[model samples]
Target: MQAVEPGGVSPYRFLLVAARLGSVRRRSQDVDMIKAQRVEAADSALIDPAGSEWRSAPSTRLSLEPTPLISQPSAYVQAKWETIDYGAIGNVSVQALHNDGGIFFRLQWNDATENDDIRDTDQFTDAAAVLFPVKEDAPLTSMGSPDEPVNAWYWRPDMETPFSVTSEGTSTTIRTIDPNLRGNGAHTGGAWAVVIGRALQSAGDGYVQLTAGEEGKVAFAVWQGGNDERAGLKAVTLEWQPLELEA
Candidate 1:
């Protein structure tokens, strides 16, 4: 074996460097490929915060692409594939409006199938979620770290109401369902529109409080029941988009 020079790089270090570079390249590509979308102040605020009033509101549409989940699989998820092909949902339209002390969001997406039944492990139901960082600088991927938690609002057609979930690093815990966290969904003409809303303040620990005119970040995810998307096998946004509340 050849003698090594002082301060010379090791093979392990070289591999780590290559991995980091690859990640940066992928991120840059995503930024270019993904078209970031934003919500504007509605002409008229939602008449019913959790209702279909958003249909009349102007929409901000965003293009969504399938996530390449390359990280090590968690115990709850057995699949180790880098990408899942669910005939990917292409885009989603979002609308937002705020009132006396809360904010509401409406998300619409097109799906060829309507999967509302969840009867077995193999059977999955259509679902969607909106994520916000507890801390302003929290990581957007892998939920979030313990120090930088993420508040997730999940909705399913079968559920009467939406529920909140918190994620710290790789761990996730379901929070109590709040009546104040209201949601209404409708599926029509091969599409689904969901309206969800919550108070401007945190209901408890592990929640993100929203305020009017304050800047925040958000991300979205969708699970196609017909395609067998469950757990970490769903399509997701590659990065967080800016969420600016109306004053």
Candidate 2:
């Protein structure tokens, strides 16, 4: 498989500004937690974002904001993007489910342009990711410190499957292929629906292991390819949203 550099803005670098701003904090108690409903064994059909099974799952709408231009890792990167507006995809709808096999997330967002292919340097493929902290106190805004790593399930339309990304602080992202990581995406009617999933338990080292009846934290990021949003220059959730998995 061809290895693609984490693009749009360097993916993990987007959080550097948050670290500098000292916004890192433990998960909050008052934030509304999104529950991952339990379901029977999921089939391939359930992996489709538009599948009927999703109708039965609870949904949450997450508002997104542009990663600050001040967060770009380098002056050149900052300069190149200073004149343009990115992160135009302001919000996304999320639904989640877990079975005996794994946990899955369905994300849908409005995008007038379907940018699935990149044929030139100026082109980019739309992308999205779901992030979870490996440790309870890990900061979602900084993508975790070396002592508190973060796990990410990342998807881009051009890839045959999603990528498993782990990071120990900003600019420390590592990407690897995980056989169990699955993704399906479809674009229609001025919108895109995508599903990304993984086994309920950790696939291996560097992966977050999850359990039922437990509470955790999650975050999200989206790159609007049509707007040249990539890497650290995308829309993101600044805070870690609470997540609960039903027993």
Candidate 3:
């Protein structure tokens, strides 16, 4: 165990705290002092069970070392994975490289579960979505009808999928779609996407809100929760295409 830093107040200075959270007793319970005193802004970091690789965080001096903080041989294998609960809003995207070598991008949306004022039940009830492109600062339009809840519109993208689903009840993949089908978070606020085919984050791998003022060269197809009752992608192929800018 490392010596604890005194009176830690800054969120970024939190590397001073260390906890071997992997340890838990099946027979008895123990209080983890490390998690109790964490100064990091997000609790998800210390507890992400799905983190297969060690990652260095830029905000703090801490390096999320290979788990099994204790020398016990079985410790690493015992940690429980945390489930990710994310809400969806219909997403718009852009995906082509400009002739000048700069990438173009765009997007807009509203989440059904995010806010009381903005939460629209059209999705969970009927599997619907909406789109607001950056061009007009567009208003929310239905993904389908409120009763049926689905429609198809092309948002351009710097389309690339790092992996493919290779299982039943799951047909998920990507294909290059259009150009000038631009959209992004510049109008909203904090956002993250694959810009110009690169994973971007306003703050490291985070998708907070979108800002229209901020544009990028990548676009993503955000699948709504209701689309997969099986808890995974369950379709043939997610359609994508090259959308040339309109003349």
- In angstroms, give how far residue 71 of model 1 lies from its true place: 2.8
The lowest-lDDT stretch of 10 consecutive residues in candidate 3 is: 29-38
**Of 1 and 2, the candidate ranking higher by TM-score:** 2
User: Tens digits of per-residue lDDT for model 2 on 108-135?
Assistant: 9998889998989899999999999998
The lowest-lDDT stretch of 10 consecutive residues in candidate 2 is 1-10
Candidate 3 Cα outliers beyond 4 Å, as residue runs: 1-99, 112-220, 224-238, 245-247
Query: For model 1, which pairs clash?
Result: 144-169
How high is the lDDT of residue 234 in model 3?
Answer: 12
Best by lDDT: 2
Model 1 CA lDDT for position 77: 45
For every candidate in turn, the CA RMSD to the true structure comes to 9.8, 6.6, 21.7
Clash totals in order: 1, 6, 39
Q: On a 0 to 100 scale, what is the lDDT of residue 206 in model 1?
A: 85
